[model samples]
Target: MPPSTISRVINATNGRDGELVTSQQCIDHIRTQRVNNIGHECISIIRHFQSMTANDKFGLPFAPFTGVNHHRQSTLLGCALLADEQEDTFVWLFKEWLKCMHGIEPDAIITDQDRAMCNAIHSVFPTTRHRYCYWHMQKHIIDHLPTLVSRYGEQFQRYWGLWCNSSSIEQCEGYWVEMKEKFDINEEGDGWLQTVYKCREHWVPCYLKDSFFAGMRSSQRSESINAFFDGYVNSQTQLHEFVTQYKKVVTHRRLSEAHEDFKSLNTKSVMLLGHPIEIQAGEMYTRNMFDVFHTEFKGFGTEFCEELRKDIVEYKVCKFTDRGKWEVVTYE
Candidate 1:
């Protein structure tokens, strides 16, 4: 994996540059490099490049690359920042793979509104699709608009509800204005909402026909794949080991997807919770178990089906049944 190699390079360079190896030593170095005993999370920056086929078969307007070299004309580039202590390292590593192996420029990138990653992207691929993840936006809403989230929980939901759910400009705008007016708090709410709307318009241009750009929305798919490494690879693990484990997971996933099918022979609905249905054969969990839903499908299930259905009215799946279990599904 490019990330595995990248991490090794980083560690080797640091080791050669006389950087500390232990956490305590690093902490001491940071203290010596600063004032007071403030603390901060360690972070790493990695850069990568990718390329996409510029063929016009997909109805794309035109290819961005221009060169006589056949290979150079279809390349795209990317970069990522991994937290030293968090499983988010997979994100950076994945970006590296896109650049080094896929030969496709990452059309879009999504992450929390992290200043470090933002800076890294600016330095690496300034023109790449790098936007703040909607999940993170909702997180901001939760942290910043706690009162609204607690009061008109549904209304608060409407804000993000429009974000990920709305397909057309009118629908998105209408819901945005309604939510803003309902939850007016000094001008902070309005300002935040307006900023979100503008950012959404800039990054999620598929909603507007004039600036329609596909593949710019936040990528929860990558997030889902990376989530598995959360506790498995943390700040304490050596960078080399972390990359090795992540590559094994990535390889297995790719191999599995290669042997997948997307055809549907039939459709069936089953009765859930006293409702009517056709498919059945399983034991219900007798106890409440903490099940972490995949990142993309979080907040979507039978319990919240009604809410989810209302919000995702304009949903669409590119293809069905990509593999035995996992599938590639995208919605707007």
Candidate 2:
């Protein structure tokens, strides 16, 4: 580690002569004899190292990293150590992962509307398209906008569908304006909308092309992975045990996906569907927040089906309720 030797070792050129007599130069020389300096350091960092985690969130907390595959069927891709709500941690973890991954290319990514995660995505995977889940945005809006239930009733739900599924920017904008007026969205709502609109160019346009993002669009699938180890995580499990169980969960998830793939090989249905669809309570999963309905028969005597083959009207659906049932929400 002598200064002169260190410089010589770091600045060695292919045209330079070999064998050095200096001990320091010999040490530096041997350290990087067959390795690229930066690459060596990066490899060493990942191998004999532990990424730090902070005990910040004292209550029920989300795992550090979670992901669902891009297939429509729910598939857990991978999970990693993550920080609770700290954008810096997400960014740090993401950056570190990029360094570890080196050159592997990713097709698409889905994540919540976390500003830090967005920033990290921009920095590390600039070419990789990042999508914010429509469901996440709607949940955030509902949680923040308390008066939405009384003001617009079911109309609020339509906003998510329109924003996430609309074919054209014009349509999304139309629904945006309608919801803005109907809900009397306050300053907070305006700010939230601005953040949500940031993804318009991606998801909005993709919907127009009939390109549905697979699992990355929703965090629900990620939660399912966490639920596998709920017992250990819920009772303040030790960090080492948590990490070990997490690895097992990942192994189980991968095996499950492989099994699903085997089951799917028998028919084309799996290819068409991409992933195994979870059969949860439809009303619990799809009702209330927003939906699609046909109101064309409002005055058509409900006989429109006779006049038109599936000539059903298409309208966005939503529901908002302030009843005591709010206390039972699975996740706040």
Candidate 3:
């Protein structure tokens, strides 16, 4: 890949009519390429490659404008090369992609704490809930507050646990105050934390407990897609090669998902415990999900009915090596 050739390739791919195809265009291409051999199942698999977007060149301030399908188990949605991370650019890209998908709005979107991206999301999907990536937030803490972790490792761990597990706004506020007092993080010294606290509703789990985030609390899905591309393409990878390599990755992922679906449909998982809930779960959920449900269900035996009222029940949940906790709930 010579410099001149690379420049030409980049220009073509980022140009008005790039070599990269949209989701529908890819499906149509696959159908046309193998019209006689491909079936409806194959077409459905092709549809899973819903979106893909590339960012700007390698050394730009903002990375490429990449988006992935959060709905289809971390599948590549679409990628496009953007001039900048402006609100208008994001709005145009989002609208174009939405039109391709027949204007279906997502329930929730998780991304890094970028003001431009947040503004664009709000403008395009007014009703959709926007969440900050927990992983990114933690990384930011590590990157900026290294001394806090280095000097007070145990305290940092405890604070992080409280912050992540707080169930209510009051609890979150209380824990945050305790954490700040314990660490002596004043407004002047820890401005990042103070700034982040203002937007706690978007990032903190306490406020997002009821939102439908589909278990994605981070941009790990997009990160994973980027990792997949690393093996096939690199900084020097030409635009044409990227398009070809992307299709290959999509094909591999589709095959892997299809195999998993087949196994999930045909196989049954053994129950960890003989609880009625476990039995019901095995019948209702896929094997992978049943495993997760089984682990949570095993803790049920630790909870005992401490008190009972006419319409409310109080359960005493014992934590391993910790004090017993009581929770009051309505009983049907």
Model 1: per-residue lDDT, tens digit, 1-332?
34445456557777576553554555565667666433432221111111112211222111111111111111122223333423334445545655675655545545566555566655555555566666666666667566546765756765765654777777777766676566663444456655656667444434534531233334454444445445455434444565576566556544443332111112222223432211221122111111111222222321221122555575433333336443435455
Residues 1-332 of candidate 3: C-alpha lDDT, one tens digit per residue: 54455556666677665564345554565567776665676776666543222532353222332343221456666676567788888888778867976998777878898888788899988988888888988888778666667765667877867875798989888988888788887778656667877888888777998797656678887778778778887755656777798789879877866776777789887877677877888887766677667778867765545444445554444434345554544433
Task: Please give the distance, in angstroms, between residue 176's alpha carbon in candidate 2 and its true position after superposition.
Answer: 6.3
Model 1 misplaced regions, further than 4 Å: 1-104, 142-167, 170-191, 194-198, 202-219, 230-247, 261-332
TM-score of candidate 2 on Cα atoms, chains taken together:
0.47
What overall lDDT, based on C-alpha atoms, would model 1 receive against the true structure? 0.45
**How good is model 3 by TM-score?**
0.64
Each candidate's TM vs. the true structure?
0.36, 0.47, 0.64
lDDT of 2 by residue, 184-220 (tens): 8655655645665655764455442444344245667
Residue pairs in clash, model 2: 64-82, 70-214, 70-215, 73-275, 110-216, 154-318, 291-317
* Higher-ranked by lDDT: 1 or 2: 2
In the order shown, the candidates' Cα RMSDs to the true structure are 19.3, 20.0, 16.8
* Best model per lDDT: 3
TM-score between candidate 1 and the true structure:
0.36
